[model samples]
Target chain A: MSKAAIIPTQLSIRVPVLNWAVWPHDASVPEGPAHGFELQYIDAMTRRRLSNLTRMALHVAGVCVGKTPRVRTVFASRHGELHRTVDMLTSLAHAEPLSPTAFGLSVHNASAGIFSIARRDRSSATALAAGEDTFGYALLEAHVQLRSDPAAPVLVVYADEPLPQVYAARSCAGDRPHALAVLLSHEAVRDLTLTANRSTEAPSGGMQSLAFLPWLAQGESGSWTGHRHTWRWH
Target chain B: MSELKLQIKQLIVDALNLEDLRPEDIGDDQALFDDGLGLDSIDALELGVALRKKYLLKLDAGDASVRAAFRCVNTLAELVHARRTDSERTANE
Candidate 1:
């Protein structure tokens, strides 16, 4: 058996094949101000619609519900309910009295809670938010969880939108609404060889030393086809 | 009374961002929950805030009578009218 064939057939599949819902610069809500990417510019891009956190949960339920399988979910949103949060905070600061609707929608983990409600999925699921490092940390957490339960697959969905103007001043990455959902399992018939080391250079310093997860999630795979740090085949 | 109900319906549509919903869509006595407009708990809270700001009506969430006042668009408008009239009488007194 080849080395790839000889590897233990753990249930956690590595880099298990997945699909994406890409959102272009221009979409349905064109006149809704420059929230993120300018829709008119990225007309050529294919932005998936079943892509929002709410919709993603619906899709996950569609995939995992009623199946003879055990799967857990991890949802990552760098700016979870950010637009709603900012609007509520702005109103509160202005002494405008908080909107109960806004307060409920502004919860960071509302997406996760909604997912649970939709699927009635009482299984273990985690919601994570960690700024720019969100994707990396989420992936790491999913990896560790999969290692613990080799039989079940871990579904990792990363979702983020551009921060509002006030928040952008503090930390903004020009990222539009982008999301990637991957099913990770130890049953690695084929998977990426991931490795890393400490470096004096900044994390996003360059291609070789760069963190590819964010770029990859944003559909920059062409630029990182043969890069180092993280390796993915197929 | 009908005019007041219409205005209240319009306010509810706008305040709740019920896109494209017209005043007629909201029946004066229709239930605002799973049976009628499919509103949820959050919408109730938002409606309360909008009522307070737009009508200048003071409402405490802790008040028991609020449940009856918020029963429907007609009830809310009536409550507002009664409250305003009471305030006027007290001011005269």
Candidate 2:
């Protein structure tokens, strides 16, 4: 639980060189092929192994890192294949043998592992889950990695699907599957600053990543206030 | 192709999530791994489970013949047909 009390004046990060989002069933989202993840970058066999969450994450990550052989990656998700986990639990309760493939792909970092395997990427990767602050924390992790190595860009991906119907009563986030990916480098073309502070505000209703979409899509430099912190783009 | 072969082909396609592929598209004799359908070890494990669940067939993971039985659509169909016949014969006896 690292906390940042002061906003550093010299802290800055670049705008995304490539950005992609997928939200197929969201009515507010445009009905088009772009939102439909074809996952053409992954072959049919490998694509079959992915759950919806992994597929979405891999799709956006693939689009962001097109042609690049190797790059650091940060994957963040709130629920992360919760449906698959539920399936595993149901199988256990029934005394049925678990599907080996399903068990292998049920981890929190499964999307990142699949992306690395599909791309044959051997670079460092990180997976984070920080409740309401997952997207922001993932971005900060990517920025830290970029600071360590200024040459290679970092691919940050945030993806999550709606919680299973069994947990619908407890779900706090939106009921749609969504994923967002961005390629971040050290070069400050379009600067963004993240500030952390204590606040008593209630957490937002939807995915934290969605808050940045308006700014990212419109290229508007503005500030977005979150549950515990705020982000500003200039 | 035989109806059993077609059913097995459909099973493979459905069980393995072979997107954009149909039963007729997969040749009866085409290899199921690496070159033809390009399935891998994980897919093989998944398809094996699907076949067992659908057909109630007994499969031994350590059996040497399992690899040969899973080479292609024709081989897999033959294996299923033979196993089903054996099970029926044993019941009749």
Candidate 3:
């Protein structure tokens, strides 16, 4: 009624949600930003080096993987470990050597890799990024992985933060840094049936996962419009 | 000599993010790599940078002496102390 909504080709998908978790969950908490959420499973040496985003990601991931014996994970974040990458970049610009430890953990999938190490999980983890549809794509990836994966459940972890001040000149839609993990298994009840439609609209700046979380929790059904695809959960 | 060993232990703990460990927890003769501290190759690389920053200690990765020097906290301390005294002697000359 407001505008002419284009009808696009849609792909139907059915995936079950076994469990879910999020981090920095309390928005009303009056404390400063903290990444020191302790986990008994992770050693001090390993936990100390992680960024807040990675910590949040790991926290939600550990929660979702609660009692599951093993899982193959797909980690998605638009700006993965951006702060660490920025630090390493600054060192390079100043002609200083990058810290070997930082260099090792600066990858996009470092959180997934650390998850594997912490759990001592030999299961494979896939890390990916797609501008606005990272979470949506992760779901797609997980669905495919579940078909071939002999594992019980596939864990999908998504987290993102606002751009660092150093890169303030570049604009990003403001997003509260939060991490979400969803466990999907074929045996579980399929709560939401996903339908992805190809669209020509520009990407909705904010994270799709953030939009999907509330819809998944509260609404009977909802749809997310991205640059290339529109995903509906009902 | 013991003070230097303690100093080296502290450096290792701080540099490697081994916050769970204290300098006193590390024995002088404990192996640094697989057996005792359980450090791996990446840790050795990180320690090399820290050693250079603190004591100007630079050892070739390919050198046999470098491996021997890093065998334990005691060996690392000896190497760092030797490097410092040698640099000081050159500075005085």
Candidate 4:
């Protein structure tokens, strides 16, 4: 990897984490169509239209949210529903009309929007993507939202599947579908610290978001190296 | 239910990804949009695609009769029955 552009890496941020959740925690099963995911949390009507990535993303988001009401959300993904996009592109190539549902939910934040609709939550939510560093940036976003409003909690969700075989070379998913979620607040049960330093190492496998789950849920601290810097969480 | 209605019901269920709903669960006259049946505008467009692909249907979204036919499975069945090829009409019965 070429030298990454210089970025501010000295400002240490401490974000209070209230709760966290992750899907397929075992890591044995790879990211694909088949999983043990259930649909009870999502209603029959809405769940019908969800793709595997969205379903996994929503599952962890729901688990983290639990009965917690009105939490702002930041859903980040490296590739948002790329499978659906591929299918649509294929249809268009043959001069075919695209599926309406596929077109409607192709945006990166579709899962976030669906979560809001399912929760009947009108709170502010953001859907974002930042290449392989999506998880780190989403945490930063949640940290900002929590600092801005001390009263409410912010939900940080990162879900990504291995790029479909066509886009596999650029994938950081390591060929496994994973979603990691953390509920952040100004003051919470655990004190979580985030710091970054410049790095020139080539990006590696494993979802950084899932790697950080251990730090939030149990371990003392962990470091994830990606995109031009190494992010340390404690 | 007539043979055509049953086929349309199956198409509706499959095309909309209505996993929980069976073909029989939908009444012949059940409202299809924003009512008891709980379909939205997107569902309408999806059903339109299903119709076009399966029946080679030519749909006119702006037409008043098209809107009416989309109101219920019974109306949709009728539209399909009227629009299908002669061989399909005879084969279906």
> Pick by lDDT: which candidate is best?
4
Tens-digit per-residue lDDT, A1-234, candidate 4 = 433444675657888888888888666665445566655767777788888889988988988888898999999997889999998998889777789999988888899999999889999999999876788889889889888998999998888877777777766544477788889976588878888777567655567776776785566688878757788887
In order, what lDDT does every prediction score? 0.57, 0.75, 0.80, 0.82
Question: What's the iRMSD of model 1?
Answer: 6.0
Docking class of 2: medium
- Of the pair 2 and 4, which is ahead by lDDT? 4
**Model 1 segments beyond 4 Å from truth?**
A1-14, A18-70, A171-173, A186-190, A203-234, B1-3, B17-21, B33-38, B84-93
Give DockQ per model, in order: 0.35, 0.52, 0.49, 0.73
Question: Candidate 4 DockQ category?
Answer: medium
In candidate 2, what are the lDDT values of residues A1-234, reduced to their tens digit?
A: 334445442344544444444444354864344346758767666677688788788877877677777889999998887888899899789766667778898888898887887788889989899877788778888888888887988888988766888998977655466788878865434555555444446544666677766655666555544566555554
**Candidate 4 chain A: worst-modelled 10 consecutive residues by lDDT:** A1-10
User: What ranking of all candidate models by DockQ puts the best one first?
Assistant: 4, 2, 3, 1
- TM-score of chain A, all candidates: 0.63, 0.83, 0.87, 0.90
Error of 1 at A229 (Å): 9.6
Candidate 1 lDDT over residue span B1-93, tens digit each:
787688789988877777557889998888776677776666778888877766667788888888677778878878877664444435655
Q: TM-score for every candidate vs. truth?
A: 0.69, 0.80, 0.78, 0.86
lDDT score, candidate 1, position A5:
60
DockQ of 1: 0.35
lDDT comparing candidate 3 with the true structure: 0.80
